[model samples]
Target: MIKVVAAVIRRGQKILICRRPEGKNLAGYWEFAGGKVEEGESKRQALVRECREELGITLSVGAEIFRAVHDYPQYSVDISFFDCTICEGQPVAKEHSRIEWVGADELKDYQFCPADGDLIEILSRGQSGI
Candidate 1:
């Protein structure tokens, strides 16, 4: 299984989400900015690195909000989702096609990857119940 890490990066009342670039795996689907976790690195470390590389920002990893094992026909992913805060730099689409900051209520409007859809639902539920 491929180990991946994603940040549920938040600022004020908005959460950051990115659209996958065309011609990439799961292209055009909206999801959090992240990448595969490399060998010997903790999930948090991978997430921080990925945010810097993919979004041109630094993140301070926070709580682990969700984890899911997703199976595709070609491969599988063990995805770890974390709550994060921007430590520095403005977000830029270094790897994604685009980026947007959406409010919790607006999350349902976007088309996200299956695993990410699950994550959004979990986050939305948590926010609503609080």
Candidate 2:
């Protein structure tokens, strides 16, 4: 399984979401910006690095909000989601096709990855039990 870390970055009433670049895996799907956890790195470390690399922002990692094990025909992912706060820089779609700060109610308009759809529902309902 591929271990990955994603940040659910919230600023007041908005949450950051990004669309995967075309030609990438799961292209065009909306997701919280993140990437694979490198060997010997902790989830938090990987998350911080990924946020910096993908979104051009630094993050203060918060609590683990969710975990999902998603299986695809080609591979599988063990994804860890965390609540996060921006520490420096603004979000830029360095790795994504687009980025948006969307309100919880507007989340349904975007097509998210299956695992991320579950997380978005949890967030939209103001329940982060996972």
Candidate 3:
């Protein structure tokens, strides 16, 4: 399984999320900011790198808030969602089509990536501080 890291970056009452750019496999699907874990790198390391690469910002990665394994038609993934805060730079849509800070209750309004299904459910259940 390919390992991945997603940042649950919270600001006040909203959380950061991004939209996949067109031409990507899951174009337009919203997801938490993160990317694949590179070989020989810890999930935390990948999360930091991905935030820079994908969001053009630096992050202070925090505790892992959630973890799940899911199989897509193309491949399976083991994903860890971490609580994070921005340490530098504002998040920009460098690799994504757009970015937004969405409230927990508004999460269901967007069409999210399949890999994010579990996390979405957890947020919807009001199990998280959100």
Candidate 4:
């Protein structure tokens, strides 16, 4: 299984979400900001790195808010979702088609990867459980 990490970055009542760019595996799907965990790196480290690389922002990763194991036709993934704060720089869509700060209730309005379904429901109901 591929180990992945994602961030639930919140600003007041809003949460950050990114859209996968065209030509990507899940193009146009909205999802959290994060990526695969590299070998020898902790989940937090990978999350910070991914936020920087993909969103052009630095993150202070916090508690794990959710986790999911999902299988796509291409592969299976174990994804860890964490609460995060942006400590430096504004978010830029360096690798995504776009980025938006949406209220938790608005999450369900966007199309997302299947792996994010359960977490989206939890967050949309304002139940981070952190």
lDDT of 2 by residue, 1-130 (tens): 9998999998998999999989998899999988899999999999999999998899999999889999988999999999999999999999999999999888989999887877888787876453
TM-score of each: 0.94, 0.95, 0.95, 0.97
lDDT of all predictions: 0.88, 0.91, 0.91, 0.94
Task: Answer with 3 or 4, whichever has the higher TM-score.
Answer: 4
Deviation (Å) of 21 in candidate 3:
0.7
lDDT of 1 by residue, 6-69 (tens): 9988999899999999999889999997889999999999999999999989999988878889
How much does candidate 3 score in TM-score? 0.95
Tens digits of per-residue lDDT, candidate 3, 16-104, equal 99999999988999999998998999999999999999988999999999998989899999999999999999999999999999888
Q: Rank the candidate models, highest TM-score first.
A: 4, 2, 3, 1
Give the Cα error of residue 16 in candidate 4, in Å.
Answer: 0.2
Looking at candidate 2, the ten consecutive residues that score lowest on lDDT are 121-130
Clashes of 3: 0
Candidate 2's C-alpha runs over 4 A off are 128-130
Q: Candidate 2: RMSD over Cα atoms?
A: 1.3
Candidate 2 global CA lDDT score:
0.91
> What's the lDDT for residue 101 in model 2?
96
Backbone clash numbers for all candidates listed? 0, 0, 0, 0
What is candidate 1's CA lDDT for residue 86? 98
Q: What is the lDDT of candidate 1?
A: 0.88
